[model samples]
Target: MNLNRFCYFLLALAAAGSLFTPHPWVMWLLLVNMLTVVVYGGDKMAARKAWRRVPEITLLMFGLVGGWPGAIAGQQLFRHKTQKQPFKAYFIVSVILNISVLLAIYQLYPFSSFFTS
Candidate 1:
């Protein structure tokens, strides 16, 4: 497989991994992978102009809904980070925001307490 496809596969694996682990560390890894794709892929002109304009909200939604891996991988595979503009900024911001939200919820929620009662 090409480097692009390989990168995407890694991203998918990361995303799938997040679903099973409760640790915030997993999300961190996924975030790193996504950021890597966004930065490197954008610099290399990997995707299209229109697709590169994908909104930060979309990325945030994906991360929030447990699809960070796919979203990140899709960006790299589709070469959707060419715009060196909003795509990069929005992606980074959204990933950080999403991870923060997930971590916050995990720590504050009474998940274990409720399950035991």
Candidate 2:
């Protein structure tokens, strides 16, 4: 299988694990995955000039759906980051969207609202 695809699979598993565990361990796993992808992707993007041709918006969408790390890795491995305009903008927007969702969840539901009182 494609290494990038494999990494993404692992990321998905890790993210889903968080839903069940909701522990620091799971969060750590998620963070590691995300950071790995981001740093690696940045390096890859730096190498390739195809930055303008790729669609970071699609990648960002993946990130929003617990695929950010994979997107990051794909960006690097594919060497798709050099054009600084759209990629950066879309990346930021993706991050903001994720953060907003997190904040909304925290503020709207301090505890388990899906369960009993």
Predicted model with the maximum TM-score = 2
Off by over 4 Å in 2: 16-29, 32-35, 38-83, 111-117
Q: Across residues 61-96, which tens digit of lDDT does each residue of candidate 2 receive?
A: 556754555655666576555357777677767767
All candidates' lDDT scores? 0.55, 0.57
**For residues 1-117, what per-residue lDDT tens digits would candidate 1 score against the true structure?**
654455456556666775566664557455655655454445345334433433345444544444556566766586654465876676677768777977787788776653233
lDDT of predicted model 2? 0.57
lDDT for residue 107 in candidate 2, whole number 0-100:
85
- The residue ranges of model 1 lying beyond 4 angstroms of the native Cα positions read 1-60, 110-117
Q: Which pairs clash inside model 1? A: 46-79, 47-79
lDDT of 2 at 82: 33
